[model samples]
Target: MSSIVEIKLSADQTEGTKATVAQWLKRKGEHVTINEPIIELETDKVMMEVIAPVSGVLEDIFVREGEPAEENIILGTILETAMSNPSNEQKNDREIRAEETPKNVSNDLPRKNPAAGQPDPPSTFISPAVRRLRQQHQFDLSQITGTGKNNRITTRDVNAYLSGSMDQSAAQNATYDAAAISPTAAGSEIIPHSQMRKIIADHMQHSVQTAPHVTSIFDLDLSAIIKHRKSNKQAFAQQGAKLTFTAYFMAAAIQAIKHQPKINSQFHEHGLEVFKHVNLGFGTALGDEGLIVPVIQQCQNLNLIQIAQELTRLTDKARNNQLTQKEVQGGTFTLSNHGVSGSLVATPIIINQPQSAILGLGKMEKRVVVEEHNGQDMMVIKPMCYVSLTIDHRALDAYQTNDFLSHFKAVIENWQ
Candidate 1:
């Protein structure tokens, strides 16, 4: 006997809670091992893969790729007895081989009611115009059957569906009264949030609602780091990589975190949790889908070159939809590099949750500033960047935050 396992959306979609099926890793009838990644879902903030809960042969898929699953409703099913069900196996295999399969099959004619029992009452005939209106409301046509001449659905049917104008005269008064209530009309446009965005939103909101935010800023002279990278760019390229200032900054940030362990502390309901290891999260922008902060664990242990190489690989994976859930989940601290897009500075970046602080880097620009060298004031131009740290005030004070930034600045400015 095949047991139907419904894969429900996890309730922890914190960013915006809107989810869409990005891809199905396992096709119907494919054998999936226990805990194997079976599907990739795109939320507002990031892409997340849902793993199989138990070992099973996937028998059927209720949802197809690129479809809306915004309600976090039941997306699909996994059958435990698929291997034994040879009939289902053959049917799905043929479907997979069919080259004419549509990207979205629901747009086809409404499916016939299942033979199991009474189906929902058919809808009235709707005109093309009315069908368009229903699409705008995210309602499907199959849910409403046609009732006009020759059983054609008309515009009037759609209008009645939307405006509570449908006939209830001695036939279906209860259905009319019940259909009058419109969820969206009550004042919420239900745009689904992507999984990544949902998680980001939840963490950000929790950080804001739970902690008092405080920020500290410092400007660092990046001349030395820039020169070093410029000199070693070719050597890095020899290893099939591009050297970026982020690697240097990340290395420095790790050192600063080691020196000032307080900045890495997390605030909890009971008290505070301090992490001994420096697992850093780098915020990588993924265009319209928003950002994903893939964590590079044990940053304090990796040297600058290693950091650059790892960041390059992780970010490339992030853009090409290749990150695992664990790759994104844990971080002791976070760094957002707005400088990549030429931002000179930013303040009060929302801290990633369970962690106390995040560091923001601005564009490196050449600036002329008065320098006191051996008691003589001399004006000189140097490559400089503005760095800001946003910390949870409940866990860290301005003085501590400032001190951490100051040490980070010193590390960057004096880099050899």
Candidate 2:
């Protein structure tokens, strides 16, 4: 008799209420190594993989693809065995079934294997989240190609297809009827909101309702910082850190926070809870999915280079979906660099709950401005960017906000 080890969903998988089985990398009777990833769980925040606890052969899978799996539930079992081979009879049966299944099941549904003219397995091989998106868009799987490992269709691939198709249709029709393009039309889909999207919506709505929001905008001259970067960028690159304007902004923000601790505080019933150490959270956009704020804890202790390195690491992890629960939590202040996407400005960016203020950086551009040079007014070209600070009025006053921004502006302008 083989000893069986249960594979349970770990508590640290996510902070969301539930997670859906995104995919199963291993099948029943397949041999798996200890600590090897066997399954992926899609939570409201991110997609995480579950690893096998002990070396064994996968014996049973209780959670199928696209099914809701609660935390600590046994997802599957692994039998103590090293055998990798499947039974000859089972293989023959699988082959026969593959041959018998239709290549395309329905025009509205995705095809199993359009190129091979064979139907996909009965399971559809798509996560519930991706399947919901496909249905909502009324997409035919045969039309879109999968880019994931082993040609699995990912949510990103489906989003790209939708974007391209919409653009093409709009161009062809010029003034397309809005009703005709609605997903509720015939052959269209109405997808229920995913858990992650719902949570985000609720949080945002609660934030707007809870705080008395106020925004103050300022135009920043980046001449000194730009010149500094041009001079030392090569040196910074040699030290494995790419010198970017964000680092300068981060450093300036830290200095401002130090000067005004109230900017890094939260309002409570008892009193104001001001934090001594700045836990800076930077927003990273994940296309089609949503945004995530990964924090660099104790940011006040890090220098410019260290801040840059930490930001790079967190950003890379966020984009690659490798951030842990801890990395996304406990932020004292938030920054959204919306300028990266070419936006000019975004006012009154909602404060991340419990955090008093949020900063938004707009696009940087060169413009001609009149300046007093050598006791005379002179016109010169300079790089300028707009920075907006949105604060919870209850926790921060306009005077404090202005003071913080003044300090921040001075730091950048007088960068050594």
Per-candidate clashes, comma-separated? 29, 1
Model 1 TM-score, all chains together: 0.66
Per-residue accuracy of model 2 over 1-416 as CA lDDT, tens digit each: 56999999766566443578877766677666787667866665555668889887788999998788887788899986544654553365455435432356322455567878875433324544455665566667766665443345556556656766777654323222244455767787544554456657766888889998999999899999999989988888777787888888998999999999999998997899999999998888887567788889999978988888888788887876667767876789998889989988897456468789998889999988899989999998999999999999999999999999999999998999
Per TM-score, the best of the predicted structures is 1
**Model 1 scores what on Cα lDDT?**
0.69
Q: What stretches of model 2 exceed 4 Å from their correct place?
A: 1-41, 49-196, 373-376
Query: lDDT of each structure?
Result: 0.69, 0.76
TM-score (C-alpha) between model 2 and the true structure: 0.65
Q: After best superposition, candidate 2 residue 123: deviation in angstroms?
A: 20
* 1-416 per-residue lDDT for model 1 (tens digits): 55878776766542334466766756666666566556656654445657786566776677777675654567777766544444555455445424222233332445556885644433232323443455555555444434332233443334335444444442233223335444586674344543456656766677689777777888889988888888999999788667888888899998998888988888888888888988888988876456777889777788888888889888997775556555766688999999989898897456566578999999988899898999999999988889999988878888779888989998988888
Considering summed lDDT, which 10 consecutive residues are worst modelled in model 2?
170-179
**Local error of candidate 1 at 256, Å?**
0.2
- Return the TM-score for each candidate structure: 0.66, 0.65
